[model samples]
Target chain A: MKKDELKKKRIIWVIWLVILIISAYFVPFVLLRGINQVEASFLYWTVFAVAAILSTIKITTYWSD
Target chain B: MNSFYVYLALSIYVLIGFYIAYKSRQGMKQGVIEYFLDNRSTGGIVSALSYSATTYSAFMMIGLAGFTYSGGVGALGFELIYLAGLSLVAFFGPRFWLVGKKYGYVTPYEMLGDRFQNKWIAIISAGTACVFLIPYLSVQLMGIGYLMNGLSGGEIPYIVGVIIASILAISWAVIAGMRSVTWTDSLQSLIMIVVSVIILFYVIYTQLGGFVSFFGRLETEYSNFLSVPGPGFFNFQTFLGLTLPWFFFSISNPQVSQRLFIPKSLKAMKTMIKGFLIFGLVYTLVSVLWGFSAKLLFPGLQQADLATPTLLGSEHVPLLLGLIAMIGITAAAISTVDSIMLTLSSLIVRDLMQSRDEYSDKKQLRIGKFVIFIIAVIGIIFASQQLDLIATLSVTSSVGLMIVVPTIFGAFFWRGATAAGSLTSIILGAFTALYLQFGNLSPLGLAPGVWTLIITVVSFISVSLFTEAPKKKANEFLGYLDKELEDKNIL
Candidate 1:
């Protein structure tokens, strides 16, 4: 991969990560607050799952570089 | 519940560990660097496993579980944030590897010393690490002792457990240094992952019925446990306080950072990074689940730290599985403690004792072994004191070590970073962290960790601006590193 392309990919990944982090904090503290505990728990898990998936995807790019 | 079963299992495990240590001694030549760093020739899998074992300690099984049990899903978030912090590895790992291989630097402090052209930087960094890490090491030993005593139904005393752990931790490192420790850490990491996975599945299916039911129960019955400040223990500021330092743990902790030096090639280093991420994700999930499981089955426990022991001792858990869990936790603690002991010994022998060029590698090797023994003895003594919660003690050490992060980043990334700035930042930041921690002061509700980091960064940058920069040396080191990295197509 070209250095420019790699840098672009990294920048995109960082933006995705930041968005996920915001959503992770938002869901539990704001959006899901006062929601049913079970539903909120599931929402939190979904957020974590998404973050985990994102992390795995990021790590998979290691070999390409 | 018999102490005999616990002893029997542990004896077999220890014997196997000793065998691995003996095997690791086979191809090793006598020299300080080779013994301390496996001649910087560690392969991908062993490096990955050793890194995993070193990073995830008894704290995962015992301390983290308890943290989740009492603190709720916030614990999960805190830990995941730590996982996210590995992104820093993606940036720093290759840089460290190239520099280490190029300079033949064994200890992280050695890198700092050379980078800043100040021996005092190396001395202070090592000394700071020693001061904080000793308590951290003792906490791991204490975890083993407590787990053993708990698993044996009080038949085996905690002191005996401490002795057993102390012996294993010391013997493995002293036997063949990094070679033995790396091999054993690989084995132990496997055991930790496998045993934790098995137990997690068993509890989720047999005890909680399945994931759906488990989640259902937690949602309905323990809603408060699903969010921050659920029980008011993990308020936002407090959570940040607990996690901010750990967010920088990849660079701040020297044991893990030093492993960046050991992989044989860039490809091998990539393998190590990928392998550790996978291992870490699985282990972190299992550990968090252990805490959640404990909270579900045994509510109303007086102390959060009792979560693991209570859950394992419950009628639903099999006796054999409990014994395996005990061994897994012991392996986790010993894996971590042995690495810390080795790193500390290297810091003392290679960085400190050999500073004046008065010793041979042979003499250094002997001194390194002696230092390992001495550290183990000190750890045993400290563990016997049975200090505060394992999580608290571990985090305190981490927070103290956070003072180094700014200086380290400056050394690597910024050309203008000066020796005076680095030294002042570290000394002041370290003292401030310790003072705020021991004095129990947190200004503006921020953790001492966050404050110390702020102060350290400001001090480093400001002092560097006003002070002399090692322009020629910085350019030489960074310039060569850049050219080499580009040549190798690693950047």
Candidate 2:
């Protein structure tokens, strides 16, 4: 892989992880409060977990070394 | 509800466990590398299963379900946050593997000691790990002890369960070290996961009337449980405090961190990462649902921890399935305890005793084996006391270990991280964790975990800037990683 490519890829993955984690902490408590259904927060977290797992799989899929 | 069934199930499990151990050691060699690391040639699937088994414990069924029972949906988020933290492994896995292979490091502490140009780094890191991890070990034993006693309707003594776990953990580990542990871990991981999945589906479908019905019941009666701060258990600061320490668990916990060095190939490492994530996801959902089922079925329980045992003993979960689940939970605790013993043993030999000029590799292995026995004994004694402090220590262990995160990240990313700074952060961070946790002081409504991270980060950076770093070693270490990050085309 090119040095620039590796650098960019690393930055992208790091940003994705930060955003994902921060959202997991804040979104359910802050944004989902007014949503009356309990499944709203529950479903939101389930979606978040699946997204994180998929993101990780994507990040690692191309790994070679 | 008879203890005889528990003993019968365990007897079969133990026999199968020993057979696997014996087979794993068939051609196993003598010496530290072979014993501690399985010669660093473990495959992807076995690595994934063992990693899963070692990471998720009895806490999943009993404690996590209890958390969900009390705190609601936030419990799922708390664990999912830890699951997401495995991203650290993706970033740092290759670096650890390359460095470990190059330096012939047996423990992550050994890697830390060498990277910082300070042997004391290894000693203190290892010492800190042993201190925090023992409580965690004892808690694992106590889980099995209590589970057996409870499952038998009080036929088995609590101490009997504790001793059984310790004896089995030591026996399997000593049989062939990593080989025995990983192989049996793979088997137990399968039993834990498959049985849990089978029974979870059965309970949810039959008892709770399936997914839609289960969610409908919770949504109608216990709606708050589906969200945060439900019944006021997981407020934002509380969640942050608990999750922060665990988010870095992949690196902070030495037993898990040492796993970065064991894959036979880079590809195998990738497989391990992906495999563990999938397993974690399925297992997390299953455990969370289990908790929710208990919340709906038996909402009048006096204590939240009674969720799992109550569910198991109720008319809901079948007798045979419950017995297997008991063994499954037991397997979960033993697998975790098993890995910790081996990792602590390796750290003791590599970080503490390696400096002795007369200590040969064989002798080092000998002492390492002896240390496992000693650790098991101490664990039994501490857990046998059932002190509030032991449970407290286990829960807050990640907080203390989180102090090592700054050193770990700096060692790889920055060249300015110094031994003095590393030592300062570890020592002070640990003290800060101890004071706040024991005193039950949460300054400004922030958790001890949050404060520990804040202090450790501040100390590590400030101390490094003020002190002299081992610049030469840092450059070589970072430079090598820079040049050799596993080029895909070549591989």
Candidate 3:
């Protein structure tokens, strides 16, 4: 956890984070195309739930010692 | 007009609220940490749910429904920024909590006061919180009244509804202070999630026939509603208006800051933030779908704000829908009212009631309860104005929190920021928000939230850089910042 390495790691993590956020913008349309309202809502929420869990892991592992 | 049951249900709800408050009084704590931040004993589930309940209120369901129905769905882009705002807030939670613990910074203004060595800034901030929060609080009262009147078949008067609602909210705030609000919010959050799911399912079933039919129907019947704001709906100004100020506001708001102080560990902080993000995404999608259903079912409604409850109350749904709608509205209103009351109570007691070191824990708790009672009375008076709940709410909150951008940024980033810089920003931001909201003076039809942010930022930056930084408290201020962060393991 030297200064340069820490800075480099943060930059890489931030880049991936941006990609994840952009991907989320398309989630509603993808899920909404399904046949039933309940199914669609469940699908959309599932994607959201997964993303949240992934981000939480990334934050903890990266930011916290 | 089968609104009689709405009134009866509401009456029973308020009575339960009073009982909860009365019951929680026995458990009131004598320590500051115990009273304000729940002794950091709040579990993950309770913390997550309380955050969601406090974050999304009648403002989200009723108020935002009006905005989407009238302003179109493109306006929902504002919500996307919230995902980022909330997540960032979560990330910063550990740092803020650590700092708060080290310096005894219970309220947001305490941080400001310590940063600038200026008590006036804290006083102004606490004052702004009180003034802006009352109208916002009134909106919750009005929403309760609306539900009561709509449900009771016009049997219960709006004034009685207001009193019943206020007393219930004040009672809750009084007994537990933050502790009761946290547990009650957890309970309310569960109710909101269940009711929200039920409404989404029923609306999709009755209106669109099913999931497949809903999207197909949306494409054909409400194509414009689903499209992103581009052609005539969104412009550069609107995009700037909706997104930028909201990002700044979310981080700076006192209620959100209060959340940052509650978590005990970094892990707890991350979980809470992630929970809120998921909640925001689900809640927005379900609420928007409900609004779209409103569009199709009642094409010629006078007010778009009433669309959700009206559609729920329509004969197509069951008696259960009416009951859930009543509870959903109540859940949203109570969650918001409780949080606002907590914020108002803290601001009055900690920042205004006594000098910083002179205040005792017991005295602060007493003053907090007293402030809650005062706010409840004022909210009742405001609810009698015959204004729509959402409009009054947005205008008032916009005016009150307009200083958030400058004040918070100045605190964290601007090393050269001065008391005068904060003062000018507060004065300019408040005036701009007030003029746009009350005097109809948003420059070239801009949203007041946007106008205020711009004014505050310009004033704060210009004043800070151009003028000399104060010499008196420079070393002490730096020491405070260093000590606050070092102890918290932030850096």
Candidate 4:
């Protein structure tokens, strides 16, 4: 609940998001080449859905400070 | 393919639009701020819906669906990357809202101009927005025209559709400005989601017999439609090229970024962000599904843009549902066009005019309305040109607007960023993007978008490094923001 804590939390989220984005960009290509189309799409969507959910949580919690 | 049905549907939509416009005008005071931004009184739902509606134009159903149909799951990945890019919103939304509220900023460029302490920064940014967004708005109008004409089997002329779209766009914005646009956009967003959901269900259950069967068909019959480089389109580089500009869309696009200032409270803004993300996710899924369904039902369509229309007119889709889908597409295009028109008008009146003393609030509102009319007329003229695919035009506009990204980031985050750097980046970057696009030349096979972004960043940073920084003003602005964010507990 401290300002420093909140800043740290936000920083963590930012780092997570950057990692997620990079993965989202490249994972599909790797998946498509290595796996079946359905598997690749499913993996891609799962990652995207997780990212979307994390974003929603991050926005909703931003005001908690 | 009854022209009468299309006309009836459009008439009903127009009547509803007029009713919404009239209601939006109630209790509305006539002033520049009130007219342009609804006096910053917009609530969360309207903000979210307007943002979603404005962001997802007819491009989603028509262009994106077609992209998926031709380019495969890379379309979904491209759009998801865009959704992922909304992380920038989470970072910048609070900063924008606090600054706008504190400074009473009317347009996004106003914030930039004030932050940089250079009116030319504002003017140039506004000019860049106008140059790119006008063509973008024209594409929205063209989408409606093509949809109506295609649905009617050419019983209605494309020009008629263009005229109708122009009229609707003008009336919606001119009638009540942001209030009317936001209200109608809310309705349109709901219609867009609902209709797409219904159509998705119908396609999956009725036509394809369910999700498993749908996937089975995709795997067994159309496996190429589910991965990158499938059917030789949407290669990794091409997909990156197309999506790179869109990744920064929330900040680069003035219309959507301006909405960051509209929610009446931080809580409301939170609601808006969450709501829009949900809407975007579901709508995106529905659009991609529509594309996959089209691939299964109607294969070998010469034009990728024809995917949506062909699916809607196919034997499986009910005529009534198809008609409703047509309305939904029209709503998407009009909602987006009207928002762009309003934003452009604001940029012209507030940022470019520079002499606010010359015009009263009443006079400013009038000028804004007049600009909207002129923009609509110009958009109609451009739409009549019947440009290339909607997706291409839409991406080109985003790439063109991407030149402003460095300037915006500098305004918000970088103190060392100078006005000289911002201006140089925008001017040179915009020219580079335009030349590459027009000349059909991509350096080293990289997209114009990537090239523009790289050049713009290099110019922005290197110039700022060499130039003097606005230390005092930067401290004042950023200091105030830090204090406000802390005081408001908005971090």
Candidate 5:
């Protein structure tokens, strides 16, 4: 309930979102190109999606009221 | 695929929907709020399913599968980001709920009108939504038309498809308003995911030789599908352009944003968010896999959109499953179109027509019902035009809606946000998108969606600084909200 705590938590989320977007975008483009295996970008994105969902679950646990 | 089966199944589906609608109205309260919003008391499970049905549409199975059939892995990334964007609800949901409860706001635009202290803001936003959404709604009807006609080999006329969709959508929506829509949407959402997933595994196991060979075949045979810019359709810019507008889709699109107001409590909303995320992930994977199967089984088709229809009609899937999947796709389209109509009708009634203290709830609900019917007719006319470019039609619908995002974020986060900023963003942003789209011009080689977001956000901030902020109202509105959220630990 403290002002600083709310501000901190929100800032953490914003930063996480920025990092998530950057990784989801360029990392797959940069890291996974030319890897034709199903384990390439397909697997990368699956892991990426599951990771995003898990992170969201962690954040949502803090929701109350 | 006989026309008789399509006719018979649809008739039975309509009867079941109507029976559910009739039952939903058993002890319904009378008023705009009750009709439009289920008196803000929808339970978590129904809310979750209805929200899923409303947010997703025929696009997932038919359109998204086709996207994967052509574009490949990028489709999954594009859609998963939208799910990740559900994190936005974690921040915005509680805020919207608190304000709606406190102000008795019937629509998101009405809330914005009050927040910005300008009636014109509400009018412009509600109108802009219609400009984009009506065509989008028409696209859903066209999906039905194409599905029914395609499956029946044109024995069923296209007009019949549109009429059937309109009747079901309009009836489910008007029959018991949100309650009927929600109940029916719950059923439709289940059928959509269930039927599609079943068909997915059926194809994988029976035809493609199960998970190991199915995925192994894709790896060896269609390896281009495993990475970015696959097959030259989803280059980086194209991916961002498509996903960016859709990422904001949750709050910018009024139909979904209004769902933020329907859950009876914060706990219910938490459930809604969790349910939608899991449903969305599973459905996205299902559609993508369906597309991959299509690519592997029936390659070299002239059109990517043919992937779904081709698969459904193939000898691989059983006739009964194929028929049920067709009905599931129809259900998906109807659920989406009806939700849009109900929200747009509320917007027209509350924001555009009625003076705040002048109209009674009975009169408003009466006009609301009438507006819904007219909206359905206009939808029929639009669908009759037959705009068939799937990617263009899909992305274009979200472009104008994206114009509202900055104003929304500014309203909630920055107290300096003003009505002038909201108007400038909506008007100029829409103009930019329309010009770029019609002229086939994307300055700097960026997409219209990317440009619209940039212009709208820049304009909103710049315009708000020059205009006067409604200081007292902002304080009273936001001051109360911050404290309430803090007390509740919502952040």
Candidate 6:
């Protein structure tokens, strides 16, 4: 891999990251509906808990040295 | 017995922390790296405790009680998983330490940039971090004002308390950077743990007669306090959405990453993890007890955030009550606010504006302090508005971080992911987060963040596959990682 190619790839990777962030604007709307406030809050936490656990796994497996 | 004393005691704590920072400035390096990251020489206990204190702040007081008040015992269930997050950190901390130490990595952005060799990754990351962290710090200040006024019988105006607390937070946090915040956080953690335990015991022994008696009383007064809410709390999309993004967030968030950068050894990392696990469990139990006890003591109350303080006031013990009211909240607000300020300063200086040329550490420290001052002012303005602490933090941080997850993960694990793919995923995810957070429109009656995460994952994968990946880019980024981690035998 040449230096130019590497820089270009880096730019592309960043662009991809931005797309993911923009997509997040729609997450809560999709999951929270027809639920009571208590139920909704609980569900929000449940997703957070699961996500924390999964991120932990991903960090362990893939975080490069 | 008034808010004056609470303010006085908090002032003393701030002074001690600032003194530590002033003294340590002599031993620090003359570069931005050393001032902000402390040259990665932090020990296990300090790193672990600091991380815990930063993560568990005023929100625990203002928000958690309100949650329990509104949701019953189900609120406790949320914190139950916090231990799992700590354990994950414990396991990951050692590895991160090894890499950070070997490569001289200072900020979370450094890790992403080094891994992907992408400058935009670092820039966007730092931007997202500041957006969330600055507002989050404001919430802590608001908590302090709320606590001081409540304890002082409304003697201290909320604005005055906010001003005093904000000024101190910036002083210690800006001066010492991580060096000061870490030590202050350690002491704050000790105070919080000791005071919480003491209060818990006092309530058990005096209020309810004993631990056993308290348990018995709880059964009679609020038996459902210990039980989980029924399937009403369990919707498929909601549950998954709430829990799944956290997995992405834990690994992706810069604040957590910054903690992992410290730790003197693998053993120190392990101990810190173990300590937080214990603390997390105990903290959850105590908070739940405190919250439910509020319901038992105050039969008719609309605002749940006041439950703990109200319970303390009911006991008729002035000094102990004042201490609980003052220190309980001081522990949460000061510890959290300072860390956020320090973290924000680091992001701006170390991550965003880092110069390639050799620079004096003193000069960088001065610049960092200036940034802290600006952030403190912004926070004061933000907190003056009435907003729920948890909502404020979630709006500012969680959604943005949730979007960053897939791209961060891909950068580390997926060789096929492209630069374009990373940017698109981040933009989409952030937009989705904002939409879910405040939008009027919805699809299938589900929250937008969930849809955001789902789409982010799919888009990231789909884009990587369909588009031609930077052929030489993968090897180059991997090459950088190999060089950075290889010397320490980390890879």
User: What interface RMSD does every candidate have?
Assistant: 3.7, 2.9, 6.6, 2.6, 1.3, 8.9
Of 2 and 4, which scores higher on lDDT? 2
B1-491 in candidate 2: lDDT tens per residue? Answer: 99889999999999999999999998888978889998999999999999999999899999999999988988989999999999888888878998889888888889988899999988998988998999999999999999999989899999999999999999988989998999999999999889989988999888888888888888889887777788788999999999999999989998889888889998888888898999998898889888988989899999999999999988999899999999899999999998999999988888877574488878888898999999999999998999999988888899989988999998998899999999999999999999999999999999999999999999999999999999999999988777787354211
Superposed model 2: Cα runs more than 4 Å off: A34-38, B354-357, B486-491
Give the top-scoring candidate (DockQ).
Answer: 5
Residue B92 in candidate 6 has what lDDT? Answer: 39
Give the alpha carbon lDDT tens digit for every residue of B1-491 in model 1.
99999999999899999999999999789987789889888998999899999999988888889988988777777777777777777767877887887888899889998999998999998998988999899988888888888888889999999999999999998999999999999999999999999999999999998999998898888778876667677777787787778878888999899998888876777778778877887887788889989989999898988898898888878999988888999999999999999999999986776453687888888888999999988888888877664334455788888888988888777999999999999999988888888778999888898888899999999999999989988998889866654455443
- Give the TM-score of each candidate: 0.94, 0.98, 0.86, 0.97, 0.98, 0.81
lDDT of 5 by residue, B464-490 (tens): 999999888899899989898788776
Among residues 3 or more apart in sequence or in different chains, the pairs in candidate 5 whose N, CA or C atoms overlap within 3 Å are none
Compare candidates 3 and 6 on TM-score and give the better one.
3
Interface RMSD of 2: 2.9
User: Candidates 3 and 4: which is better by lDDT?
Assistant: 4
Model 5 TM-score?
A: 0.98
Q: Where does candidate 6 stray beyond 4 Å? A: A1-65, B23-26, B90-95, B230-242, B245-249, B354-363, B387-396, B440-442, B468-491
Comparing 1 with 2 on TM-score, the higher-scoring candidate is 2
The order by descending lDDT is 2, 5, 4, 1, 3, 6
Candidate 2: residue B112 Cα off by (Å): 0.9
Chain A only TM-scores, each candidate in turn: 0.72, 0.86, 0.55, 0.67, 0.83, 0.41
- For candidate 5, give the lDDT of residue B83: 84
| Model 6 lDDT, full chain set | 0.64
- Model 1 chain B lowest lDDT segment of ten: B482-491
lDDT of 3 by residue, B1-491 (tens): 45556656666665665565566556556776677777766666667788888878776667566656665554455555555555456345665666676677788787777677788888888888777778777877888888777666677677777787777677667676777777777777777777877887887886679878876776666565554442244344565565555554456667767877877666677677667767777777667666667777776778878887677668766776678667777877887787888887787777775474687787777777777888887788788875654355555574458585676666665678888888889988887777776765558777777778778989998998887766456555555655544443333
- Candidate 4: misplaced stretches above 4 Å? A1-3, B387-394
TM-score of model 3's chain A, to 2 decimals? 0.55
- At residue A21, candidate 5 shows an lDDT of 70
Query: What's each prediction's clash count?
Result: 0, 1, 10, 0, 0, 89
